[model samples]
Target: MKITVDLDPKLVWQIQSEAARRDLTPGAVLRERLVSSRNTLELENRIRSRVMSGMCDADIAADLRLVVGTIAAVRRRLGLRPNRRKPGWAA
Candidate 1:
């Protein structure tokens, strides 16, 4: 879903600068901001609880009828690491 668009050089520089300052890629920063603006508190809460309970973003996204990136965006906003292990699987 990536589209090429012309952006002012100054805006691009600002985005890159903010990204570096936050230790994130420019795309991550943009996605985080977009998701934060669009997602509801209840939806965010659901994602948070499921993520904390060890659900992977794909599974949460599937169950919630949302994109995996959206789940990831919400998870990042919650400051949680990506879930690597599947739920209920012994290590």
Candidate 2:
């Protein structure tokens, strides 16, 4: 399936650069980049929201369907301390 998107010039340049570096077509490079970027953003947002709402690491681990260390890593990246409080929402 082919879809049309209006990529800005900067993005186009980045795509071309990555394509050249990886020996991939621009489309292939862009697709891989977008997929990973979208997934990472979604994962980070979920973890960030939960952490900001004061969810515990273990609970967040279960909520995100990731390991406890994954939750800790996101917290570290976001500069958030563990919310030692009990889980904000029911398990």
Candidate 3:
């Protein structure tokens, strides 16, 4: 599958750098990224659909926050702590 695309120079550079670091070509990097992005979008769409189908916003928010917190806690337990601030900072 060969296709032409008009990509931003900065993004192209980043992709190229990542490809080099990973010993892969730009095409492979792009394909992997596309697949991952598509999966994430699909998951988000499914969640949104569920949320829109008579689910309470507070309950949904609480469930999502709990999941996120659990993931963070697991990461910390596994020594993979992220470098972000606590969840509720003034944006």
Q: Candidate 2 vs candidate 3: which has greater lDDT? A: 2
lDDT of each: 0.84, 0.87, 0.62
Local distance difference test, candidate 2: 0.87
Off by over 4 Å in 1: 1-39, 85-91
Q: Roughly what TM-score does model 2 have, to 2 decimal places?
A: 0.67
Residue lDDT tens for model 3, 1-91: 6899999999999999999999999999999999999976665654455344533333434555546554344344444424443345322
- lDDT by residue (1-91, candidate 2, tens digit) is 9999998999999899989998999999988988999998898899889988889888888877889998899889988889875734654
Better of 1 and 2 by lDDT: 2
Q: Report the error of model 3 at residue 20, Å.
A: 0.5
User: lDDT tens digits, residues 37-89, model 1?
Assistant: 67677788999998888888888888788999998998898888888757565
Clashing pairs in 2: none
User: How well does each candidate superpose onto the true structure, as a TM-score?
Assistant: 0.51, 0.67, 0.62
lDDT, model 1: 0.84
Better-scoring candidate (TM-score), 1 or 3: 3
TM-score pick, better of 2 and 3:
2
| Clashing residue pairs found in predicted model 3 | none
